[model samples]
Target: MASNNTASALEKEQIFGLAEKEMEYRVELFNKLTHTCFNKCIEKKYKESELNMSENSCIDRCVSKYWQVTNLVGQLLGTNRPPV
Candidate 1:
């Protein structure tokens, strides 16, 4: 029926809208994380083409700690469903 079709179309549109929002949120979060870790772990000057061992370790630790804190806050808020 036309009504059913209209409802189905609306439902799909909403689902797609939600998916788009999730993607945007993820991209924004990634950008923030990258900026934070790079600033904290790497020097302001670009002295090397590749990260040194210490720089690599610092980034790893920074990301690990970021996620740990994220998880903790998520748990505290009861929103700690596994990542989508």
Candidate 2:
């Protein structure tokens, strides 16, 4: 029926909107994580063109902790549902 079709289309639109929002949220999360971790782990004094071993280890720990906190917060907020 036309009404059913309309309802389905509306649902599809809503799903698409949610997906878009999710993508935006993920991008923002990534940007913030990048900035925060880089600032926290990487030294301002650029002694080398590439990361040294200590910097690399610091970055690894920073990223792991960031994800852990993110996941914990997501779980607390009940928004950590497996993606559809």
Candidate 3:
């Protein structure tokens, strides 16, 4: 009984660890994707001029639009309930 309890606790800890690692990985991936997409969408002629008012505005719009699309797709997928 003691051994069984220990094994169950170990399994739970392992699952929790796996979930934490997965969340970290997802955060990293999101950061990378955001950075790459922002860079590609907003071209910079020079370092100093990269984020002038117009450029900042454009970047903001692009980011907003991207999030909107992502949310829409997520909703669609959630409703469809695709096999996991």
**Model 3 residue 68 lDDT score:** 67
The candidate with the higher TM-score, 1 or 3, is 1
> In candidate 3, which residue ranges exceed 4 Å CA deviation?
1-4, 7-11, 14-18, 21-25, 32-36, 47-50, 79-84
lDDT of 1 by residue, 3-50 (tens): 999999999999999999888878877787799999999998889999
lDDT for predicted candidate 1 compared with the true structure: 0.85
Task: For residue 75, give model 2's deviation from the true position in Å.
Answer: 2.7
Better of 1 and 2 by lDDT: 2
TM-scores of the candidates are: 0.90, 0.83, 0.58
- Give the number of the best model, judged by lDDT: 2
Scored against the true structure, residue 30 in model 2 reaches a CA lDDT of 85
Candidate numbers, best lDDT first, in rank order: 2, 1, 3
Local distance difference test values of all predictions, in order: 0.85, 0.86, 0.70
TM-score of 3: 0.58
- Candidate 2 TM-score versus the reference: 0.83
Q: Better model by TM-score, 1 or 2?
A: 1
RMSD of 2: 3.3
